[model samples]
Target: MLNAMSFAHTVGNIRHHFPGLPTLLAKATPERSGDILAGIAAKSAEERVAAQCALADLPLQHFLNDQVVPYETDEVTRLIIDTHNAKAFAPVQSLTVGELRNWLLSDEATPERLAALAPGLTPEMAAAVSKLMRLQDLIVAAAKIRVVTRFRTTVGLPGRLSARLQPNHPTDDPAGIAASILDGLLLGSGDAVIGINPAGDSPAVTAHLLRLIDALRQRFSIPIQSCVLAHITTQMAALESGAPVDLIFQSIAGTEAANRSFGINLALLKEANDAGQKLNRGTVGDNVMYFETGQGSALSANAHYGAGGLGVDQQTLEARAYAVARAFSPMLVNTVVGFIGPEYLYNGKQITRAGLEDHFCGKLLGLPMGCDVCYTNHAEADQDDTDALLTLLGAAGVNYIMGVPGADDVMLNYQSTSFHDALYVRRILGLKPAPEFEAWLAGDEYARLMLEATHPERLLTA
Candidate 1:
């Protein structure tokens, strides 16, 4: 049996005590408005650092013992425990959380080694180590790990970047969506997947949008996959109606309760994954599920509670969501980082930090991680902030990013990176799109303008 545990640290004259593991995790988290709003943030900077100091000394094995959300009530916790690779974990099993952080930044954590370590590290463990890292640390460590996946094309390969061509429209108008699709394609984007967030959820509407995108792909012989980002059930229904479903899309959260709030569970996700796989649609690879998560989703849903009713911080909950994603061997998993708005992220710095954290944690946990790198009008962030984050993610070797027209989603009413933005990153970072898609960009129809390096406006006119 485990003994009762208490965590405390002294900063200057004050001794701060964290009553429980959840509280320690929460207090140790970097300052974010979401934790502050949830009433779980440290009362002062000193206390926060004290929590961090205390957290650094805690043995890594304790996370395996302490259930932040008890295993019985939360299947996410159960999944973490039941699937953990004990042998893989043995290397770092003896170390404290702080030692894990140092090792991650050390020369030993190569891509292959980190990939092997992925099955060993739990989300709480990843989140714990992340709190002790700076932004550059997050970037350098995340870049060292590679979690590649495949659907119609390869993603997460080193020295390559991909973009999700999000041709979203306010009315789901075919013409407008096609125009945006053309824009992304001409600009050498959409190698990740041409995903559309439908305005309506009706099965018929979803099916129609699926047909539209599939038709475009077939007609052009584009070496890419297409998805209509509807709910899982809606996508399943559309699939049953014989829609050309290439990938199943859903918004997932950390806790079982938060997932329930989203009208999803593990069984349901498995059903959807099975449904997508049975289609036999993917040519290059069979990874067919797509998942999107954000930091504040659990708190926003009022399902962020842990053992003893202490609130789990949003970043930890976000990391937990990655466990859910990894379970399915998904083709794509991205955090819609700033899309949750200022109430959670508050400003540019927080958004940037959260993006790096999400990317780092997701990569650490063996997911093909990406970020939306977006914000709303009400948020205190601007285009410059988005550009900075976009470039940073590029440098971090992020697998994919969203490619919206003009950096704006008319339907979702948010600002994201544009097709031109993808070009800029590729030029600056010496990255290219997926190999299959790059070959297609050199085809007859697009090669004249795209490959020859003629003016972009000429392709626009074409």
Candidate 2:
């Protein structure tokens, strides 16, 4: 029989024992309200540290052997295990999770080496090492690993930061969305994408929005892509009905059951991916998927159980979501960090920490990871919190951030970064928009348009 895996650590006068890998992983995660709500967070600070210590001592190979979610029951787990590159793993095969952290932070872990190691590292291993790292360590280490992707625009380049211009309208009105798009363009946003969350999911509405955005893109000759963030099935229906589709968008989670709750499966995602690629819509390259994930998605769906039917922590589950993103070779992957509200993240500090952790884990896993630096109204956070997080993410080399007008999404009823927020970060960090978009922005017509910019509200009547 295979020996059971257990971990223990001595903290002052008490010794804490964890029964298995899942339990240890849960207890080691930094405090978050979602894990507490799931009844899986560390009981005390000492226990959290003890679990971290034990996790540091555990070898990296244990992750491959001890699947958090069982392979038979979870396709995500199988994908993670089945697709691991043993050849790439050769460099750090014997290192413990703790040593992995040290190596990642060491001078020897150059950008090329880190890029080479990306396919070998699993999400679980990424989460474990992140728990042992400080905030600066997270930033420094993530900066070294660059995972670039391209559609019409290039993203995740070392010195470039992009923005998603979200021109959402409460009624899905074309005029309102057009005005907002004009606002974003004038402010130098929309290099990442001009994606909208439709007020409804009717494929007719989706196709209309797609055509509207595409019309504007063609009218102005902007070198950017557009997406209507409807359900994947709705996008597929629209695509079938001859709507212009640039990138297929979906919300994915870690577990099979959670994904089912969202009415998606791996097969369905693959189908959507294939459809988008067949459109041949991209001008620069063909990485044609956009995925959004959050920490509490699984538990919220009542699908957070791990090996032996124990509750897995939310952060680890969030990391697992990256595996799903990596598999598709997506153009963009972002954690909607605070959009789920305070129930999961609880406060600004927790949201900030989760954003950094998500970025670090995703970049380490070789994905073009961005962040929706945002919060809902009811959350214990304000604009300042998003401002702090946005600046930090820029410094950490985040690929893109959301550009909701005035930092408010009237349709979605949440606060995200504004178009000016993108300008602020780019100015301060010496970062520019994607190359194609930047070239367009520097054109004489763009400068003349900026100087002759009109009131955005007037566009509705015009």
Q: Give the TM-score of candidate 2.
A: 0.97
Query: Against the true structure, whose TM-score is highest?
Result: 2
Q: After superposition, how far is residue 160 of candidate 2 from its true place, in Å?
A: 0.7
Give per-model CA RMSD: 3.1, 1.8
Lowest lDDT 10-mer window, candidate 2?
453-462
C-alpha local distance difference test of each model: 0.91, 0.92
Which candidate number maximizes lDDT? 2
For model 1, the superposed segments whose C-alpha errors exceed 4 Å read: 1-4, 445-462
Instruction: Report the C-alpha lDDT of model 1 over 228-324, residue by residue, as the tens digit.
Output: 9988999999999999999899999999999999999999999999999999999989999999999999999999998888899999999999999
Report the poorest 10 consecutive residues by lDDT, candidate 1. Answer: 453-462
The CA lDDT at 136 in model 1 is: 95
Tens-digit lDDT track of model 2 for 1-462: 123467899988899999878899999999989989998889999899999999999999989889888998999999999999999898999999999999999999999999999999999999999999888999999989888899999998889999999999999998889888888998899999999999999899998888887876775678899999999999999999999999999999999999999999999999999999999999989999999999899999999998888898888889999999989999999999999988799999999999999999999999899999999988899989999999999999999999999998999999999999999999999999999999999897576556545654443432
